[model samples]
Target: MFTGIIEETGTVTGVIRHADLWRISVAGPAVSADAAPGDSIAVDGVCVTVTAPPHDGVFIFDVSAETWRRTTMEEWRAGTRVNLERAVTPATRLGGHLVQGHVDARGSLTDRRESGAAAELTFCFPEKFRKYLAQKGAVAVDGVSLTVAKLTRDTFSVAVIPHTLGLTTLAEKKPGEPVNLEFDVIAKYTESLLQFRGTGERELSEDYFSERGF
Candidate 1:
């Protein structure tokens, strides 16, 4: 799991295509410091396994075809700046919301406006993901955990402070650019548990509804 706290922005140095996998090399000193083969690294919110040990502050990863279909990594090329985060450890401070580096979907930037030292960015995502959104809820966009400042029928917005803008790729994002999104995992789990309370095939329906007078 990750904390959605970007350690630093990394630059893509190489991308080599294979039959069913692509080998990507990224240069990040902090992220590669203790990284080893098979370690988990969140690259723009998608958990990718490190395929090779870090070499001169650069680490390599193998991206499978399925991962390509699920994330924006397919669009990555040399010189692309990506948010980087290492897997959280027990002793690590939870600086940001819990992030699994499992992207739920991709969204596009719809609008951007300045708010003094901060900037508000509006995004439009898949309608099916609307259930996971709520005002003041946490959302990870491109691996940066942010709070939902506003919500609409098909859109949501987050306020990005100047520090966040400077440390991550979010500042370079333009309208219509794709961004990977990971909804709060706790909310999804809550929704799943609530389903067992309703009239479904689940065994807890009878006992669950009786206590709540459903």
Candidate 2:
């Protein structure tokens, strides 16, 4: 798991395509400092395994066809900058919300408005994922954990502070650019548990808890 906290920005050095997967090499000295061949790294919010040990501050990852189809990895090319984060350890602080590094769906930036030194970016996401979003809820965009500052029928906005903008790739993003989005895992799990009511189970409600002596 990841904390959706970007450690640094990495540059894509090379991309080699094959029939089944594409080999991608990224240069991120900080994130790859102690990375091993099997370590999991979040490249722009997508969890990719290090295929080879770091060499000269470069790390290799293989993107499968399925991952490519569901993410913006296809748009990546040489010299592209991407947010990078290493997986969290047991002792690691939960700086941001829990992020699986699994891109649920791709979204696009719809608007950007400057707010003093910060900026609010609005993105339109898939309709299926709309139910999982709420005002002030946590969401990971391109692996940067942010809170929903506002919400609309088909869009949500996040406030990006100067620090986040300077450290990650959000500062370089423009309207209409595609972004990888990972909704809060807790929201998804809650929805899944509520769906169990369809299996002839009792509906979950305040009275259910009250009756249980809560």
Candidate 3:
């Protein structure tokens, strides 16, 4: 679990091809400070295991083919900036919404508008993901937690503050650029529980006791 708070803007140091997998190395100081082997790190919104512990704040990530297929990491180049975040701890402050370091899918940026002190970025709403999105909902794009400022049939916009622009890779995104997107996990869990409630072949209900074959 994570808070969707970006700790560092890590640079992609290496990209190695092994079969269909990619061994990536990212350089992040804050996140890699207490890093150890097998630790979880969110790189560009995807949770990757630490194959190599931090060496001078650099961490190595081992990514699978399916993970790359679901995210924009496959387009990463040397020096590409990515959002780096460590898992949330009990003592850590919840600065942002809950993020699971899981990318649901990739979306393309379609428009950008400037507000008084912020910028509103609109991205095309993926057909399958539309059901999960709504105005004022939480959405993690490329690992940055943002609120949906507005929603349309085919697009959703998010307001980006100055800090977000400077601290995360969202600043580098341009129109038509692809970004990794993760919907609020709570939404998925809630929908699952609601949809499957009492719909099983063997219906279970509070009105019927266990012995009554409810």
Best by lDDT: 2
Q: What's each prediction's clash count?
A: 0, 0, 1
Cα-based lDDT for every prediction: 0.92, 0.95, 0.87
Better of 2 and 3 by lDDT: 2
lDDT of 2 at 171: 96
TM-score, every prediction: 0.91, 0.92, 0.91
| Model 1: residue 47 alpha-carbon error in angstroms | 0.7
RMSD of each: 4.2, 4.0, 2.8
> Which ranges of candidate 3 are over 4 A from the true structure?
201-214
- Cα lDDT of model 3 by residue, 78-175, tens digit: 99999999988899998889999888989989988777667889998577778888789999998888999898877889999988888988777899
Q: What is the lDDT for 30 in model 1?
A: 98
Q: How far in Å is the alpha carbon of 40 misplaced in model 3?
A: 0.6
Least accurate stretch of 10 residues (summed lDDT) in model 2?
193-202
Tens digits of per-residue lDDT for model 2 on 1-214? 9998899999999999999899999999999999999999999999999988899999999999999999999999999999999999999999999999999999999999998879999999988898889999999999999999899878999989999999999998999999999999999999898788778877889998899999
How far out, in Å, is residue 47 in model 3?
Answer: 0.8
Sequence-dependent TM-score of model 3:
0.91
Better of 1 and 3 by lDDT: 1
Model 3 has an lDDT value of: 0.87
Rank all candidate structures by their lDDT, best first, as comma-separated numbers. 2, 1, 3
